[model samples]
Target: MTIHSRAKVHRMFELVEPIATVTFSDVPNEAFLAIGMRNYWDGYFAGRAAPLGMVPAEVVHAVFYNFADGEVARHIPWVWGKTTPAEAIAVRERGSALALRQLIGELADSAELAQVADLATRAGLSAPTEGRVLYAGLQALDVPEEPVAKLWHAATPLREHRGDGHNAALVANGIGGTEAHVLMALAAGMPAEKFGRIHHLPKAQLDGVVDGLRRRGLVDAAGGFTDTGRATKSRIESLTDELAAPPYDVLTPDELDQLIAGLEPIAAAVEAADH
Candidate 1:
């Protein structure tokens, strides 16, 4: 239904209340005011029987309605529009599906940090309420061991990784030491492109990697890679043999663990700071 501004606050009240689930003890004098947009997410969860949403209306407004972030003191209309529970449900379902598909699919395919980020944006558009969750969740996904997985897991740009392959090829063809540079770039968390440019490599050859993986059914390219792609990532990580003796110069296991822990917050900060 086309919600009216006059009724919007009331509609929000209805959605936020049931999900708040405050008991007598939990209720505070301040609870009466609509849960400040800041607290909505912390006090909430996703899927069913949770807060009206995984995120606050402000976040939804920002994502869907193109509402720029406001300073804390900025005044907002009492109600933007009346969004019913039914509307929230429809919005959530569509958003979640879009998030899961785009974010995961892109991560599986590119294996590069930038591509993963781009997918996060694409998926974010699917469901603003849950887009952050989806975007953050995809990082935790295990990349496969195929070409696609390598592209993603190398955490470098696709072109750079390909250049590493080319460097390797040159070394393999008796020109220079390819494998060490490949490992070094991967270890340093630099994009494959950086290495390629630094080493004066031509464009990395992804066609063969992509095609070979496709022919072997190691990747579900149609869906942006697959379980097979995830497997390929694992294998490549193993082959890099860094897991056993990972380049401490880049990241140690403990350091990697710390990075993973802060991954979501860091990504959010990066996005927030961009504007």
Candidate 2:
């Protein structure tokens, strides 16, 4: 069995997802809260924009077309106008750290998170520091947030950074946006036709992507990944892990071990709260 077995990849994803989710998906009750939602979004965009050198809003607008459609991206000022990139970045570094600290504090005071503090500390140390460019960038802007939130916040940038890297890798390797979408669909086991429909991409274009992938021996006529395709996916995942590992350099081995041991219960508690 390969080390980056599907299960291993999924488990790793599960461990890191909670922290990332609360920062975005777990918005306040209203869709648009004056303070909480905007601040959270500001931090989110800030973290996202860091690698791009705080380019102007128009640059973000131009590039985001690859990720989101015009109507959707155009609706918000963060994506287009009202807030300047500099301000967004500042808010991201300051507000997110503060928010993370407050969230961790709330959880620690009301829940059993204190029991896992040492473990969380250890776990942070355990994360490897090499090849994690995105993680390292976020770490350079490190704040005094509480341990768990700090870890959580730390995890988000690495994840997003890897995603950014993945997009670059795809383009560099001659895969266009449409083809990249198809490859991801194959990796995730979604039907190509359905994926095309859901994403509002044309069937002909998607079929073209699949055909190109087949010619390259990356997929089969049935649109499933060939052995070569699986290998490629694994390589991409490995590359992503390498890119995400740099921030954990600050943690010592013992701290990493304790964090590994401690995170499960805390994660479970977070899940329980969500339900």
Candidate 3:
């Protein structure tokens, strides 16, 4: 199937997010408690154009303030004050190489995923454009300079940039975070109860968001989006694509197509892994 640049980018995210975020699920509790904090912090803090020294509270204010007021309490479950920001940075700086190295080994061992990587290599995406975009985001990071992850590093940075750009689109369109999440849930055909967990809103707060959406004619009483809501979500996605298009400008249409083709099987493989 033919895919647009935006769709290709979204597929790339499907391939990468699982890899980048598996630290939360795959690593042992002790290992995660020990080193995962750095991974989480760097992944979020990096590629942001905002100023440095943004504590978790400040991060909530800047990015998620549009959601419920007490979201920070519900959202961030990690122990605060357990690790200093400096120490977390230090850990990410020192440990990223090892973590990335191990991840590379893991990917290498997977013949299924290896085929995907090989396809990406054959698609003229092996080095320059992907690396360039990856490093561009790394340059924006508040962390001290360090060597790039060197393999599949592009995925994390690109995902981060996409997330930032998506947020910008939502803000520009006057969509609150809760409403945005609800819109997406409707698009995905998710049930209502899942909204509370997925969007970090209380059930009552989520109902409030739904009620507001209903009043706006975006959602019906049953929680599905109306036609206008679907159109609005499409526009939001289009705007996000426009904002995210800059880093990908260097890539030709053919290359983006190749990327989409190359990543589809890998994304499918990832999804089927637990089945």
Candidate 4:
């Protein structure tokens, strides 16, 4: 894909992602709790990893790429013992659908949603499976017949497909999981405390990562991106976008435009409700 097309593809998926991922917010906790899971991390890891079956923590840690290993190990395997992968998948889909219905209101049942679901499913299934472990797992699942659930199911693999590519880009550039988070934090101007809390990285470890970045001229004294840091961040994102572009090739230009336009308001609704 050309740079322009790659960027467009990235933006399109960005819009589609919230349709499925809004369940990450507290709104969908009841769905997970109903399945006898402990807490958010239990559902988060279990639900996302369900398609891969009862994989161990090491596999989840490797595929997930950026989460702390201990955090992953705290859940996986243990989560599987609590609930089967099929149950986890069901609750995740249920939670996502409930969240979307609540947030989007009538839009959840609209023909536009159905159309976008179809488009996204086509795009997602068209993606190459080579080296995309997470996406491949999602691809093996059956698409749901319910409009909202179908949309979430379809958007998932597309999201994971890009995520797999993003992880590949990070690995190719010699960035470790915590290091990737550090670079992202600096690039986005996210506070160090927030990044540390989210990623479960200790202050000392975060400092070490930052100091390493500084040595490579990727971070400045003020904990912001240096010029080299900004360039490197841009390159990583560009490569991720490029790798993520192939799936969208299934859509005609007009179909792509329709998918993005249809999803924009739905994504906006999710954002509004999430806050």
The number of the candidate with the highest TM-score is 4
Candidate 1 segments exceeding 4 Å error: 1-210, 220-227, 237-268
Off by over 4 Å in 2: 1-13, 26-47, 50-80, 85-107, 110-137, 142-149, 164-178, 193-198, 271-275
- Better structure of 3 and 4 per TM-score: 4
Q: Tell me the spans in candidate 4 whose CA falls farther than 4 Å from its real position.
A: 1-4, 196-200
How do the residues 161-215 of candidate 2 rate in per-residue lDDT, one tens digit apiece? 4555565565546666556666678777897666642356556755776888899
Per-residue lDDT of candidate 3, residues 16-130 (tens digit): 5654443333332234347444444333332121223334654544553345565444324343334444454344443443444344444544554444444332332222233
Alpha-carbon local distance difference test for all models: 0.31, 0.52, 0.52, 0.83
lDDT of 4 at 10: 79
lDDT (C-alpha) at residue 197 in model 2 = 27
**Weakest 10 consecutive residues of candidate 4 by summed lDDT:** 191-200
- Of the two candidates 2 and 4, the one with more favorable lDDT, higher being better, is 4
**Best candidate (score: lDDT):** 4
Count steric clashes of candidate 3.
Answer: 0
lDDT of the structure predicted as candidate 4: 0.83
Cα deviation at 41, candidate 3, in Å, is 11
Query: Judged by TM-score relative to the true structure, which candidate is superior, 2 or 3?
Result: 3
Clashes per candidate (backbone, < 3 Å): 18, 8, 0, 0
